[model samples]
Target: MKKKLGMFAGLVLFVVLMAACAADSSQEESDSGDSNSSGSEDSSAENQDTTEISFIHWRGEDEEVFDDIIGQFEEENPGISVQMNTYPSEQYQSNAQQMLRDGSTGDVFTSFPGTQFETINNAGFFTDLSDEEFVNNFAETSLEVGQSEGSQLAVPYQMVFNMPVYNKGMFEELGIEVPTSWSEYQAMAETLKENDITPIAFPGADIGPNQMMNSMMMNNAKNEDIFAQLESGEETLTNDWWINTLEDFQHFNENGYLQEDALGTNQDSAMQMVADEEAAMLATGSYHMASLKELNSDLELGFLPPITVSEEEVEYEGIHTATFMLAVNKNSEKKEEAKAFIEFLSQPDIASQYANETGQHLTVNDVDYESESLQNTSHWIDEKDTRFQPRYLIKEAAVEDAVLGSIENVLGGTSPEEAADEAQQVVEENID
Candidate 1:
């Protein structure tokens, strides 16, 4: 399984971040209101000297593209220049949090859409972009995910669609059409298992399980106002969507439909099973397609909405989870300069360039995905039938952590009901 950035890549990000750390004293001066003394507030509107601002982000692979974008921004706005710095994923959040808390985070930084972004926004760490012209470029739903309590605290850079990516060739060979209903899906799994083929590659890890939970919630619990009920203390994970989804997952586990020792399998291993023709399907988000293709260039992939637990109420839908919420640090003295960068990137052509290069969908209007694998899922999103991951409604990490643990337990021989009840207890104890 792949883990960690390569040594050379880690060193590059480390050195860049180290240079950014040199601006620490400037943050103290900015926080003290000393930097504002040089120019009257209105002078910026008239004419201002060229200013340099810092930008910090987490994706190492995006450094070159970001630097190119910065270059374009500088060319467009001769008065502002953006300096870019990046870090590996593990160190990114911790360092970004500490820097922001200390009022030393650079002028611009990237945030996530879930609990991490929620915590930072509530801390007043980001400027509100709700009324900015650049914000108007965002898709309505993307803006909704990037906002907190109706305030657009950040701008989304790219979008994600999480669905099952199956081997199209394998399905064709098995004479299996893409299953639209739950029972049909089960039948397909049974046929694969009887033929001594692993029906699906479920990495016994938590992410695929989490994706399953989101799918079930979107399908079966849509009418229940599940999040509202959880918020009001009128419901818990032990009921309805939570229990049924857990049991459905357990059923797949006990029936040998999922590859053995799924709990011990890592995501890359699960994907490898599909690549090597040992399994016919894998549940994942579109973001992994680039990496999967790198592993098996000949792989013919197709996205499928997972079969829901209930066929009576809702039909299957693809899932969309937005990523890379770009925010101007509230404490940065160069916020105006940061906003210039945001505005520059918001241009449809510029945003599409970034999206096309990165294999992600642009959050702004009219920018299409360049990845063929991602394009396979675009029809659902284009038709507005896709759902956001359930985590968007959840603000606590405990919800996911508990649910993933229950999945592991279910695979380890625990009764689905008992395990699900325990999962509910986790949410009950952790709800804010």
Candidate 2:
């Protein structure tokens, strides 16, 4: 009986040992599987960390805001890094043009929406982003500028108008209501002059003022379609509207409503006229509000550019956009990631932050910035039904020679009719 009991105990111990060995083998396999899975995940994460993008744009007040937003974007996207580059505003166009010609520019770049941009697009220098989801997120008009034929060469980031900004205190003190028509504008200028203030403080030293004058005239013209025909050489500047517009420009210059050295002064010096209170009003973009505020935060600044024939409003059709765009180099190695960066910029929060920081209105749909000036200007634009500037209606070069350059002659004392004729000759030369 004792031998039998001992044998039974030995059998039970052997069974317990066998169960322990099986449990250890299964635990080892489970640990090995977990190790393999973790290793695979680490390799995948490392692969994603290699993606990098290079971005470039022109310098403005928004540079710091842009960099901050980019840093945030990089944080959200662990695998991506953004490299930002900027060029001075004065040299932006030429610098971008030269870079496009060389095809050695950064992965991302800036371009305007006009003949030069179209030319660049046709040359296949910029990546086509027509199918991108980001392209669909913009307003129709904003998107139109970036689309060439069927391809999108750039992303539209903002829209700006060449509206008139006035000193509210000055207007109130002079008992002047904002002008709503061309006649009222002229009368207002005269009134301002009578008050010992220059009615319009324009600087013709740089090509900017002439460009603004030309756009304003065309906006108030009877035949707005003549610009396209004139550009193509299919139509001459024989339209009454063209002649009348030129006459109005001459009227402003002849009346001494503009500054004396306007012909020799750039827009910056011209703006100083407003800053110093030598002028009652200055025609400029909404972006100028920041600088104006910086000069005099208490200065009551308001917008007054109207598109109309009388006090009543008229139809408007123009491309009043920033003319600045973000494009991708077609030869970029990191095109996808660069595109993702652009996508991040289009987000409403990002766009609003940028505009608020820079004091520029962005093209983001239904997004509002904290700028009362921008809100007021945008509301005023809608109220007046102002569209894009007519100067942007045609290509830049044609507008430069035919419209912008010839305005200098008019300001220099040539008759508006003669200046118009000379400008017509330029249009004819560029025609096919």
TM-score of each: 0.83, 0.81
* lDDT per residue as tens, model 2, 160-213: 766667788889988998775767877788898888898766756654553365
Candidate 1 pairs with clashing backbones: 204-262, 204-263
TM-score of 1: 0.83
Query: Among these predicted structures, which one has the highest TM-score?
Result: 1
Q: Pick the candidate with the highest lDDT.
A: 1
State candidate 2's TM-score. 0.81
Q: What is the model-wide C-alpha lDDT for candidate 2?
A: 0.69
Give per-residue CA lDDT, model 1, range 72-115, as digits (tens): 89888987767678888657766677777654456888887777
lDDT of 1 at 158: 78
**Model 2 CA lDDT for position 112:** 70
Candidate 1 overall lDDT versus native: 0.74
Clashing residue pairs in all predictions, respectively, total: 2, 6
